[model samples]
Target chain A: MPYRFLEDVAIADVAFEAEGRTLPEVFEASALALTEVMVDLDGLSPVLSREITLTAEDLETLLFRWLAELIYLKDSACLLFCRFQIAIREGTEWELQATVWGEGIDYGKLPLKLDVKAVTYHLFVIEQIPAGWRARVVLDI
Target chain B: MEAKKIAEGIWEVPRTAKEGMLVPARIYATDKLFKEMDQGVFEQVTNVACLPGIQKYAICMPDGHWGYGFPIGGVAAMDTKTGVISPGGIGFDINCGMRLIRTNLIEAEVKPKLRDLIDRLFHAVPCGVGTKGFLKLKEDEFREIMVQGAQGIIRRGYGWPEDAERMEDAGRIPGADPAKVSPKATSRGIHQLGTLGSGNHYLEIQVVYPGNVYDADAAKAMGIDRDFQVVVMFHCGSRGFGHQVGTDYLDLFGPAMKRYGITIRDRELACAPFASPEGQDYFKAMVCAANSAFANRQMVTHRIREVFSDVFKRDARDLGLDIVYDVTHNIAKIERYQVNGEEKELLVHRKGATRSFPPGHPELAERYRATGQPVIIGGSMETGSYLLIGTAKAMEESFGSTCHGSGRTMSRTAAKKKVHGRDLLQRMEQKGIYVRAASFAGVAEEAGMAYKDISDVVEAVETLGISKKVVRLQPIGNIKG
Candidate 1:
């Protein structure tokens, strides 16, 4: 697993740390962690695809917006994604473009876990660790 | 930060406790309660005191716990002119609250049908994570809900018009500019108007405990006349609409903070000056989310009434099912308060705390004017809940705010590790509290042991006269998402 859950951080919310060699790789792992919090991603099939584009003034904000956009898709479209293909670029501004793949939620077939309210910036950090890029995200569940 | 006992059931962290603090941070708690609290609350409360234009003190209720920026059960009033508005202080679940409904039927009469009633309710109200609500509203119709709130639902024939007056702010806070709400928020809100979202959100059937009425006149006014009288209570918020609003603004305010020359200790505390354009826009959008929650709860109440009427084979009106009150604990509102004996308008942010207006307050309904606004505090499922009334002390000391519920003492993961859902279900069943949950793991996450003892927290407030106890209710059936 590229991501691990953080325990005892929040009374009511969930948190996780995702790591990879590149920004896009870490972003994908973070997205996976988010979906896994909602449902059993291993049993899910990426049968549908949705493209998302987000822009922010900084990399940290970009990551927050990206996760928030995924949550928005889950609530608005009732989609549960398992795969993420993401690209990140920084010049004068920060931008994230991603192709997220998931299928419509079939409650009878999928065992839903918890409803994540939103992403929180509490103790949120993204940095290039010695090995790769690492990000810590706390989700309000 | 160190706390000094200032009064019985009150502790104060002086301004000298932290740097940049404008005022002291006060916590309402007994000695034992204070010791039981997590240490993070001290830091969070002090951080809240550092906010610009913070009036009097940053207040934390007895049930306070560590939260993102402001501790859960935090309350602060900011000056409208120089103060700032923070989405963190308002919380992610905008207008998340509790609503009580009283039915004429007694517990003895409904005991045999409890399972059936819960089943019907669970089906009538779609629940669980990412579930779509029954209301298939068009885009314009949904926008109307964002603006009109509970009244909009009533206008659509989903609720009784009389129920509107019993709601806090008459179920609609004015100045809701729907256009300010983002397209993402609207999209998420369109299908989630009536859903009971998961994670500690629930609908419970409760009975008035015998001899539990502390104020007979007040309880009677709320339709709690006799022992064993049945009532329904549900906890939820603006659903996806509110979450999206908080998300969008956190992003907007992050950049806007630099332009306003504000610095925050935490990123989640990103805010803008209340009078700034960004602040005004976020406030308008927040109102829309708050209104959406009102509509959401009203729709759920409508469904509950329908389910009750269907199961009991009686007219809904004949059942005497009426709203007692709906109170939002998580919200920011502009209200006039007496500051230093001078009436001034301030923006009050109450996160994990409920507004408890005192007796004879003009904002209360006529029936409750002499009594006070009903403050509903929801305990964990295994524990009973309480109905309390506001006090003058709360108005004078804490901006008319009181604890919302028994704040969690255990993390969700820790709670899950401590209790198994199947075993919890059996335990509740043995205690005559039937529970139907969408997921077992979710159930474990909300184990009763995860929270502080509600009675202790309630006693702290009652002892301080912040809020007075009215009645106690024990749950008989519960539906969790």
Candidate 2:
């Protein structure tokens, strides 16, 4: 599974765990987990695309900024992204470039169930497990 | 971490409870309330006490729960000269606050029209996830609001000038430099004025229940003269504008911590010295968010007045829709408090806690100086809320702060799993409470069982003499986002 909801992690917020074999795949799964909190991902259509690029000092901060950028797009651009194509590179600094695909929300057809306010660092973890790379994030809803 | 009872409703976690704790941690809670608290609260509270230049003790209210760095309902004051300021201390939704509006009409007069009133109010205020607001301001106009706060909207005919007097900080805090706010935050906030953001934000129609008025004179001063008198209460904050400000600062402060030589237990508790350039910049930006929230609430209040007039077929003024008070729950303010019998200036951060200034405090407006600042506590949709007044004891003990609301006891996902939204709706209907939410899952997540009892929390504060109850207002109808 790309992502699974983690129960009982927060009193008023929601938590989820995402995994992939590579850093970019984990980033994609994390992005999908975020949108799934707002709406049913299966019902969403990727009708448009927007490119995004973010750089951070480390992989963890990179993930934080990546998720925050997606939330900002939803709030300012009024778009709900369902698919994420991410590429990560580590050199002098950690950098992420991605193209997110989604459509303007049709409220009548795909009503939002929750408003994920911000991705929090509480108990956030990213590591390489035996099976693959895994990341856990808690969202302030 | 362990706590020992220090007083009737107080518990103390000694400085030795954790390494590097500069001060002891205190919590105001009954045994029952303490049992319901999460273990993370113990860790977070102690971590707050470990911050540099922390004065006295790090305190948590009766409704304290687990949060990112500071536990929700946490209160801490730091020395302005040497202490550090953390963006996490004030939540992402900066100045997330409460405003209570009182009406002359009573419950009996409103029962027949409750449905129409709630429906009209719901449509009047834009809510829910990914929702835009009514006002789309130009860059200059948005910056004006960031600087001027509610005064900007009041000048535009959104509210009366007198309304500003009843608001905390007169609806504006000084030192709000619009230039300190990032362009991205401004864009997110431009079209979000007068909007109610989702997740625990709501507009509720309530009635002062019979025999629930604890202080008749105080109640009367708040425009609650008779039993079952109608009122409206809203819980919201600065929206995406505030969130972006926090996000930007957290990124800035996290790296600045190493430069300041501050060792923090949690990454979320990132900070810089108060006198440092980075710290001063964050404070200025925070004030901008706080002021913007004041304006946001003022605009919403104006929309509510318009909706009431339309539903009652009378002018809003004639309907007697007036603001009782507006109080911010999440914010940091510079205030003077007595430390070691000498008055000193300190930066007070109250996250998920409300300021409850006692009677005769300089902060109270002329009309409310004798009655004390009104402390509004919102309950769950199924339970009732309270109207409280600040007390002098709170000034001495908690720096004039008290519990914000009934804190969550269960996780949102757990609540959703336990209660079906349709079933919760039916249960509320049977209890004569009308709830309108954008999504059924939203209702399920906020089910009454998910939170602790407001009465228990209020009783603890009352027993501690931090705040006094004036009236109990039960919800008749609610609009949730």
Candidate 3:
């Protein structure tokens, strides 16, 4: 696993730390952590797909929008994803393009966990270390 | 790091505690609760005090805990002319609140049907993640709901005409401009009007035993005269729509802050001047979300009435399922308050806090004018909830605000590790509390052990005379999202 749940990071909400050797890998890991909070990935199959393209001024804002988009899709379309192919271009501006795969929720079929309300900015950070890149996220549950 | 004890249940941190603080930060809690609060709350409350145009103090209720930007159970009143409006202070779930419905049915009548009732309600009220509402609204109709709120549903025969009166702001606030709302928010919320979103949102059937009635006169006034009286309480908000609005504004405010030349310790506390175009736009959009929440709860109320009527074979009106009161815990409203003995209009932002307007306030309906606004405090599923009333002291001291719920003491992961979902269900069943949840794992996350004691949280406010207790309600059946 590329990510781990951070216990005690938030008392009422869920928090996770994701790490990868690159920006795209880190973004994918963060998305997986968020999805895992809602349902067990072992039971989820990627039967459907969605392509998301987002642009932001900075990597932090871009990460925030990326996770928030997944939450939006979950509520608006009742979809959940377990697989992602992400690409990130970083410079004065940042751009992200991802092809995500998921399936429509069947409450009886999937073992659901919690509802991720929104991606919050409290103690939200994305940083680069000598090893690679790491991101910390707190989701309002 | 130490705070000075200014009064009983009140602690103050002077402006010197932080470099940019404009006013002192005040926290209302018993000594025990103060000790239990996380260090983050102290930092966040003081961070709020540093915002420009903050008047008096940045305040936190006994239930205060670490949250994004403003601490949960936080309150701050900003100057209208000079202060700024931040979505962080109002919370992501705009108008996330509690609604109490009174019933003539007694505990005995509900006991036999408890399991059936909760199961029916669990299905009737669409809940859990990725849940869509029964109503598939058109864009124009959805926009109308953003403006009319519960009144729109009532007009469509989903609710009684009197239901609107019992809700705060009469279930609708003025200046809700649908044009201010974004298409993304509209798409996210269009189908969620009648849903009970997951995470700490629940609908419970409670019994008010005679021993629990503290203020007989006040309880009777609110229609809780019978021993073992039954009532329904549900907590929810604007669902995805409100969250998208918060996200949208927060994104916009990031740039707006730079344009206005304002800087803050945390990026989550992004804000803009109240009278600025960006600020006004977000406020108007927020009102739409608030109204959407009102309409969402109204739709749920309709379902509750239908379920009760179906189970009892009686008309809903005859069953006496009247609304006791509905109050918003997450919101920002422009209200008049006395600051330094001078009457001033201020924008009061309450995040994870309830408004407790006292007796004879012009904002309340005539029916409740003499009794003060009813304050509904929801406890954990394993414990009980409380019915209280606003106090004049709340107006004088805490901007007419009180704690929202039993604040969390343990993390979700810890709670799940400590108790199995299946075991929790059986334990609650043995205790006479039947719970029907969308997911068993979700239930474990909300175990009573994860939170502070409800009575203690209520005690702190009652001790301060911020709100007065009317009755206590023990849960018998519960439905969780």
Please give the ranking of all candidate structures by DockQ, highest first, separated by commas: 1, 3, 2
Q: How do the residues B217-302 of candidate 2 rate in per-residue lDDT, one tens digit apiece? A: 99998888877889999998999889889988988888899888899998888888888999999999999999999999998999
* Deviation from native of the Cα of residue B386 in model 3, angstroms: 0.4
Better by DockQ, candidate 2 or 1:
1
lDDT of each: 0.92, 0.90, 0.93
Chain A TM-scores of each predicted structure, in the order given, are: 0.97, 0.96, 0.97
The CAPRI category of model 2 is medium
- Model 2 over residues A2-113: C-alpha lDDT tens digits? 9998776767788999999899899989989999889888888999999999999998999999999988887888888988888899999999998989988677888678
TM-score of 2: 0.99
Per-model TM-score on C-alpha atoms = 0.99, 0.99, 0.99
Report the CAPRI category for model 3.
medium
| C-alpha positional error of residue B289 in candidate 1 after TM-score superposition, expressed in Å | 0.7
Candidate 3, residues B27-145: lDDT per residue as tens digits?
Answer: 99999999998888999999999998899999999988888899999999999999999999998999999999999999999999988889899999999987888887899999999
Task: List candidate 2 segments past 4 Å from native.
Answer: none
DockQ of 1: 0.83
**lDDT of candidate 1 over A1-141, digit per residue (tens):** 999988778677898999999999999999999998889887789899998988888889888988898899889889889988898889799988889898988888987888999999998999999989999998997
Model 2 chain B — which ten-residue stretch has the worst lDDT?
B127-136
